[model samples]
Target: MQLDLTTFILEVLNFLVLVWLLKRFLYKPVLSVLDARQQRIQGEMRKAAVLQEDAARLKQQYEARLADWNTEREIAKQSLEQELARERDTGMKAIQQSLADEEAKNRVRAASAIATREAELVRNATSGAYRNAAAMLRRMASPAMTLAILNILLDDLASLSEKRQEELHKAAHPENVTTMEVVAAHALEESAQRKLGDAVAKVCGKPLQATFKTDTSLIAGLRISLGESVLHANLADELGYFRSQDKNV
Candidate 1:
C-alpha cells in the first residue's frame, strides 16, 4: 500500500522486460510450431482429396475392364457353341451317307444273287428237255423213215437259196477233187443210190461221186460229209444242234 515511485517503476520495467523475453523466445517459437503444424495438416488434407479422386477413377477403370472381360467371355462362349453345333451336324450327315451307301450295295448284291438263281434254274430245265426229246426220237427209228428223210434232205439241198448254195459250194469244194461220203441209217437199194447220186451231182454243179456207209446208231435219216464239214438230217444231228441252241439260251 506504500506509494513508492522507484519500486513501482522498477517493478513495471521488470514486468515489461519479462514479457518481451517470453515473446521473443517462447511465444514466437510456439507460434511458429503451430503454423507449421497447420500447414502440414492442410497439405495432408489436399493429398487425401487427390488420392480419393484417383481411387474413384481406378474403381471406374476396373469396372469397365471387368465388363469388357465378361463381354469377351460371352462372345467366346457363343463362338464355341456354334462351332460345336456345326461339328455335330457334319458328323450326322456323314453317318447318314455311309448308311445309304451300305444299303445300296446290299440291294445290288441281293438282285445279282436272285438273277443267278433264275439263270441256273432255266439252264437245268432246258438241259432236261433236250435229253427227253433225244430219247423219244431214238425209240422211233425205222429204215423206211430213214429213206424218206434222205429224200427230204436231198430235196432241201436242191432248193437252197443262192447265198446258202454258195456257202455249201465253198464248204464242199466241188471244184477240187476230194473224197465225199454219204452216210445212212439203212443200206440203200441200187436204184435209190443211183438216183440220189444224180440228185447230189445236180446240186453240186460238178460231176460228183460219193461213197455210202450204213450206221444203225444214226437212228434215222442221212448224213453227207466233205472234209471237216458234215451236212446232216439225222435225229442225232438234230438233237445235238437243238442242244447247242438251248445252252446258248
Candidate 2:
C-alpha cells in the first residue's frame, strides 16, 4: 500500500490496447463464420419444400393419363367387334339369295322339258289312228262294188229311149223311187253299205234298190225301213270311225 501512480497508469494503458486489437481482428472473423452457417441451413429447408411439391404434381398427372389411355382402348375394342358382326350378317344374306335364284332357274328348266315331251306324244297318237280306219272300210265294202255297176244301169235305160224308162219300172215294181242319204265315216263312199244291203235283201228277195255310202252314221238311207234295224249312218261320223279303225290296222 505504498502509492505508485506511474505503474498503475502503465498497466491501465496496456489493458485498453489489448481489447481494441481483439475486437478489430479475432472478433470480426468469428462472427463471419457463424453468420454463414445460419444462412446455409435456411436455404436447405426451402429447397426441400419445393422438391416435395413437384413430386406430388407429377403423380397426379400420370394417374390422369393412365385413366384416359384405358378408356380409349376399350372404345377401340367395341368398334372392332361391331364391324365383325356386321360383316358376318351381310355374308350370310348374300349366300341365301344366291341359293334361291338357282332354285328358280332349275324349276323353269324342268317345266319346259315336260311340256315338250307331252306334245310329241300327242302328235304321234293322232297320226296312227287315221290310217287303220281307211283300211277297214276297204275290206268290208267289197260286195258294194256291185253298186258301182248299178250306176251304168241308168245309161242302159237312157240308151233304150224314154219308152224303156216306163218298161223297166213296170218290170221291177209298181213304184220307181229316187232317194239320197248321208252316212257315217265307216260307210263313207265305202262299199260296205251296198254289200250289207245286198246280203240283207237276199233274204226278202226284193228287187235290189240301193245307193251306197262309206259313211253309215246316217239315221236312215234310201228311205228304206226294216222291222227294227236302224243303221248309224251320219255324214260327219266318218271322221271318228276312221280315227278308231286306223290304229288297229
What candidate 2 gets wrong by more than 4 Å, as runs, is: 1-48, 94-187, 190-249
TM-score between model 2 and native: 0.33
Q: Which ranges in model 1 have alpha carbons more than 4 Å from their true place?
A: 1-95, 174-177, 185-196, 214-219
**Which pairs of residues collide in candidate 1?**
none
Backbone clashes for every candidate come to: 0, 26
lDDT of 1 at 28: 94
lDDT of 1 at 24: 95
Q: Model 1: per-residue lDDT, tens digit, 142-211? A: 8888888877877887788888777666765645646578888888878778877777666666546789
TM-score of 1: 0.63
Instruction: Give lDDT: candidate 1, residue 33.
Output: 98
Cα lDDT tens digits, model 2, 1-249, are: 786899889878877887788877888778777777777776776777777677777777777888887788788778877887788778777777777777777777777777666555544666544445434544444423324333332233235544544443443343433222323333324454554454434433354555544333322222233322232222223445564564444
Q: For model 1, what is the C-alpha lDDT against the true structure?
A: 0.80
